[model samples]
Target: MQHTVIDGVDVYWAQGPAPMIATLTFGCGVRDESFRTLGVTHLIEHLAMSTLPRLHHEHNAMVDIEVTKFFATGKPAQLVDFIAAVCEALSDLPLSRIEKEAGVLTAEGSSGCHPTAGVLLARRYGIAGPGLAPWDGPGYDRIPAEAVTAHAARFFTRGNAVLTLTGPPPEGLRLPLPEGPRVVHDPVSPLSVDGPRWLAEDVPCVGMSLRGPSVSPVDAMGLQVLSHRLTEVARKEKGLSYGVDGDRASADSASTDRFVWVDAREGQEAEVASILWDTARELATFGPTAEELEHEVAGFREMIEDPRFVDGDLDEFARSVLLGEPYLSPAQWLEALAAVTPEQVAAALTESLRTALIVVPDGVRLELSDVDGKLVELGGCAAPEWQPQGKVFKPSLLARATSAAARGARLYLAPDGVALVDGGTRHFVRFADVVGVLARNGSRTVFGRSGCVVPVDSDLFKGIEPAIAAIDAQVDAGLVFPPSVFAGD
Candidate 1:
């Protein structure tokens, strides 16, 4: 790959087939926003694109977990105009259009990865970082104009951006982004949990997340071979699943949470989950045959040797450059992949299987034997057995008289945070770790960085005023939002 610097931004390019393309990608994305400001990045992309003049050229923008891209394909002049306009818009975003764009985003709905992918991430890391993928958060319409300005200034600068091209840099190309320091993001951290466990979530398919080293050839091939085997057995033979796919998320600079998700055929969720579990166990215990290993290697070779993959290679390099991640050239990756053996694949799976998290549709249960023939049952995000050491408020007189559930609920308010106790189980979130707090009228729902939600509302208990007041006083003001007045009390 060829590289240079333009106006303080890194520029990378490669020679490829006709119909040249260019991408302006920044390191900031969904993971960078607070829970209250979840859709802020998507909104920024829309705000920038809204500034573009209508043209015949094919151009668009998109935002994902860790990068936002503004891409276009056309003559050199058109490409030049597209990026310049994007930088200008980002530098002076139309604050007046905040309400309009916010509504458009709210109507557009979910952002980032697929819902199943988000759910899998949330299950692993909670409602922060990669886990924030699945939620619309406090609602995009609630994002403040100041927040939007601050976010764009912090991330959409020349120092933090990378420009990639399928051809050499076009003449007169310039990145006019405001000068700012590069933002170094913390590596994503998984919630501290033990062992491989299966649990039910509201997802449509059966999914599994295995924690392992980032971009490891052995782990990648292990997942690839397993995916192919599942497609063969689950789809071709049993007809229990319609699609088998996978996605990956960075857990840290050196580790990743790789996923293998299978969408089931209605009443077949249980069977699909079982097949996924059993096949992974079988492959880990016995490894793949030589024939199976060769087939995947052929696929890798086709990609590595093909000139058309130049653009793909350039994009990967751009991501690595912007995020400061370790980059592996196509040749480097191919060499590593080609050298992988069945034993290495099996060993990788064997180790990652220990920290695997599997999710099935609600009410579906998984019963399986581990590689050692031990019956292992999966668990869900059950609350830890402990009570908040704080002031306790009993149920409201009306709640006690009207409902058993409300009668047994107790609200705890501590200097550090809050919790709700119901049926001897506690749901809690500390103010110090809050990702977001949704406020409506006098009611507030606290969202913890660890994925717990504690509602300090009137319906659950009495004397809720103090709890609500405490929340407002404790959490950062910027991390709290009233979604909408029309959302009701």
Candidate 2:
């Protein structure tokens, strides 16, 4: 790839087929926003794109887990104009348009990743970083203008962007972005997991996520091989599933996650989940055959050698460049994949399954096994074993008299924070670590940094007004917010 610096941004390009394509990538995404500011990255993308005038060329912009990308395909001059307009809009966004654009975003109803992948990420990392994927946060319309401005200033800058093209730089191409230093974000780490477990969620498909190497072709091959094997078994033999898809996600600088998702036919969700789990176990035990490895290598080669693949290749390079991570050229990556053997692939899968988690659709019970060859049951959100001690408050007399569920619930209010005890499960939200609080209908729903939610609703418990008062007095006023007028959330 060819490289140059234009208008304080790194530009990369190479000759390829068809109308030239220009992609401008910024090193910021959903992972950078706090829970209160969730959907802000996408909000920014919408704000920038909303300013563009209608044109005949095909152009679009998107925000992912790690970066926001704007791309257009047209004549060289058209691309120059498109890119310049996007940059100018970002540098000085039309703040008046936020409310209008926010409603548009709500209608669009988009997410950073696939639904299954988003669930697994939240399971793996709680509610911070990539874990924020499945959440709507305070909602798009709820995001404050100050938060939007701060995020754009910190992330959408010239030094924090990389430009790639399917051809050489277009004459007069300029990136008129705000002058700022590159933002270095800390790598995201997984929340502490007790062990390998299978769980059921309200997902459309059955999926599995395992911790693995982020930058290993061998690991990639292992996952591809798994996908191939599932296609053969789930789709062809049993006719239980229609598709099998997965994605690679970077968990940190060194390690990453490999996910495998499969959608089952009606009345066959359990069967598909069983097939997926057994296939993974079988592969982990025996590894791939020489024929399997060769087939994957051929597929990888075919994908990399195509001229149109230059876009994907440059995307890989841009991710590494913007994030300060290692980069492997197309040729170098091909060489590494070619050298991977069956034994190495097996070992990689074996290690990854040690941290594996399988999530199936509702009503799909799974009998799974771990890497250790023992039977395992399904798991869900685990709360602390012991109840937190504090000023105890029982259910309101009216609720207790009317509802059985209310009779069993209790609230423990303490000087530091509060905990909700519902039967055997306990949810503790500490004021010192609360990330966000939702205030609506004269109640406060507290969100803790540790992924716990404690609702201090007056109707639920008697004498909870003091508890609500304590929460209001303890939590930082900045972290609390009311529902947006555009929507109730």
Candidate 3:
């Protein structure tokens, strides 16, 4: 593959067969939009591609957290025409059908399940920048068509885009991108949460996210090997989980985030969480065995040497360049992987555990503790205090339950808000932030705009129907989302 700069846009060219693949990428996605303008980039993507003429080739577009890409694979002439058409569309986006496209995006988001990484990011970082999508609904109706056009003009420029091809250059190849300065995005600012924090979800599996340095290949490899070892022990040896895997994402120019997740059957979440912690601790403390290291290294080498690896796709290169990281060749990557030692892997794991976040299924608590002595509970800023006027429901006080810790808590309902007093700690949820009041199995849960989950202890609380109805009346008519949205499903 050869790299060059054509008309201020980076181009990567490689020689291949007749039907070639070409991808055009931009350094803008969810990370580039503010919380209020969350889905603008995605809307632009849909609109830009909506104008393409039908062709006998495979063509599609994808918008990720940090990059937006459009790709096509077919004859050289077909690919050339597709790329030209896409560029023209982006240069001057059609906003006539924007509302229709936004409805499509909203419907898609409503139907799809949120990923664990997105939930974790939203919890660690507030609904701003990269953390916008998980916490808030798509900003389709809020963002006007003029803002979409402005966003495209700023990000879809020659200076911030790249074109990569896997065949000879096509005849009459032209990109209709405008000349402009490259746009630099601000790094994501994550909230400082204590380690080993757990967010309760209604899923049956446990998910863990560990963050590490972005530019360290050795550290990345270590986490990969550790994930493999944990999966082997949890799924193969104990039959506790169905599958386990690990993935990495670019957090910033200087840092990378890695996630290790395990899925278990119902009634197995606690055990799975325990085993995951144990494996992580053991790997960080003693390092990988010789046999394990050998196998992992071999696998790594094979993957790098695979013929299909080739020069990375346009999206990968765009991410690397935009994040201010170098793209290593396969030979260079193999050398780095081979040089990684067990001690290094162990140290990497140890460092990653310092700020790990553990998410568990509902009603299942893990006995696992962090490397530190205490585990900090994650929450948002305290709600402002206000007077309680409506009927007060003391379900826990009436039940006289003594088995649970929160059994002594009190729920005070008001015309404008709800308050829960547990011992000395008081939590207030204002009507404005109360998206919905979820009632299930005689219990009530309040979801706050800050992603706080306040559940009335069902074991001790009784007759929450009145409280649910009172809270539901305060919420806006169209603002009530399904319980699954808060379940991290």
Candidate 4:
């Protein structure tokens, strides 16, 4: 893998063949942006893909808690043009334009109340805009546009970019070396303030951000497992969001933070808050089940091994450029997986749930209630607007998107590209860029952390290089970086 500086953006590059797949991940930190603008960055990404026409078909975008992503495919010839357009947008998307496209950031978590389906949802959440990103939407409204633009200028430094390429190599492909100073790491931590605080938003919601003493990777994984399980059990009541889960992260190399959130409809906000408080308190008193504990370890192991898990890394160079973790040979990953245990998960959960910092957002104007969950009448909030975009793609597209995700590609369509049979998968790449001529015998191999495999073979390997280069250029331009880079160290 090679790293370079282009127009002040850190660009990292790697090359390979046909069935090419590329991913551009933007890291703005989880709490870096605000809760109100939770989906703002996502809105920008989606708009760039659907609204912008020059990039053509196959380009796509989305936003996550810690990063935003852009992915594209089709003719490799158009890669550079697409990369330039995306970079231009990143540097200049006006906040006012976004605010108009998305609804007003009336209150913290107000956007969260919007139904999951809509243009507004994409616009309201995730990282984007300015100031140090915060846990809720206050930062979105508080940060000035100039500060946001300046933030963009500083964070999108040359060292922050990494380009990953998969499939065939294009002729005269240039893997540029680091040209300038390394992208300076952010000095201020991306984490929110520790302990509980009352967040009075349009909708009543309760949440707690816990500081776990253990920061070990194994413990981090354990905490995640625990969060998933606890969320599953707690959500048995139909009144709550069934899959309300917690997220565990190691901000620095030695400290961990876990956030658990729960919200209820209008009048039930206090009850929901009490339920969450009790749920957390119970972990220390009742403890996790032995089977649950065992499953946590097994689940974590499977997650680590799941072939379809695209925590980023296509040319395999992304792990080094973005994560900075010692790039372990494939063998080392297996050994590390083997060493994790169930006891560790229980301990992690025990430590995490001992104390609670609860937040209940009652529609009432900044009303603070006691620890016991009880309702306080509040005014109703108006429903927000919703909009949805992106193409209705076939599941097979996934086989081509991930390197560890390829099963096989077949020549059903002849010379240009082949139909990649990716049954039971969730990726979005075409088959022509993923399979190799040598693997044309029609066998199967799973890619990523999920056991997603394709079972057909196509002579698709021939034209994948240009596709890889095209996608590589976008990621290299600093449009995106994966969460795993910020998952731990």
Q: Give the per-residue lDDT digits (tens) of candidate 2, residues 216-305.
A: 888888889999999999999988888999986675557777889999889888888888888987888888999998888788789888
Worst 10 residues of 4 by lDDT: 443-452
Over 1-489, each residue of candidate 1 has an lDDT whose tens digit, in order, gives 788899989999988876888999999888887788788899989888887889899999898888899999888888998989999999889888877887777667756887777887887788878888997687767878888898998999998999999889999998899999888888777777766777778887899889988768889889999999999999999988888999887755577788899989988888888899899989998898888888888888898688778878888888888777778888787788788898998999999999888888888777765745644444434333445678898887887888888877888897788888778567877788888888876888888877788888876567788888898888888888886632432
Q: After superposition, how far is residue 186 of candidate 2 from its true place, in Å?
A: 0.8
Q: Is candidate 3 or candidate 4 better by lDDT?
A: 3
Query: All candidates' lDDT scores?
Result: 0.83, 0.85, 0.70, 0.41
Each model's TM-score, in the order given? 0.94, 0.97, 0.78, 0.50
**Per-residue accuracy of model 3 over 1-489 as CA lDDT, tens digit each:** 678776677888766444688888888877677544567888888998999877778999888777888998888888889988988898888888787787677677731113666666666655455555464443465566777888998999888888888766677778879887767766776666656676665544687777767757667776777678777888899888878876655556666567778888778887888888888888889887777777866887776565544435344666676557567655666678777788988888888887788777667766666557555555433345555456665655545655465566777776677777666666677777764455556566676545444665465566667766666677664444333322342
What global local distance difference test value does model 1 have? 0.83
- Candidate 4 C-alpha lDDT tens digits along 363-397: 43333333444323221111121122222122245
Top TM-score model:
2
lDDT of 2 at 43: 91
Best by lDDT: 2
Model 1 CA lDDT for position 179 = 91
Q: Of the candidates numbered 2 and 4, which has the greater lDDT value? A: 2
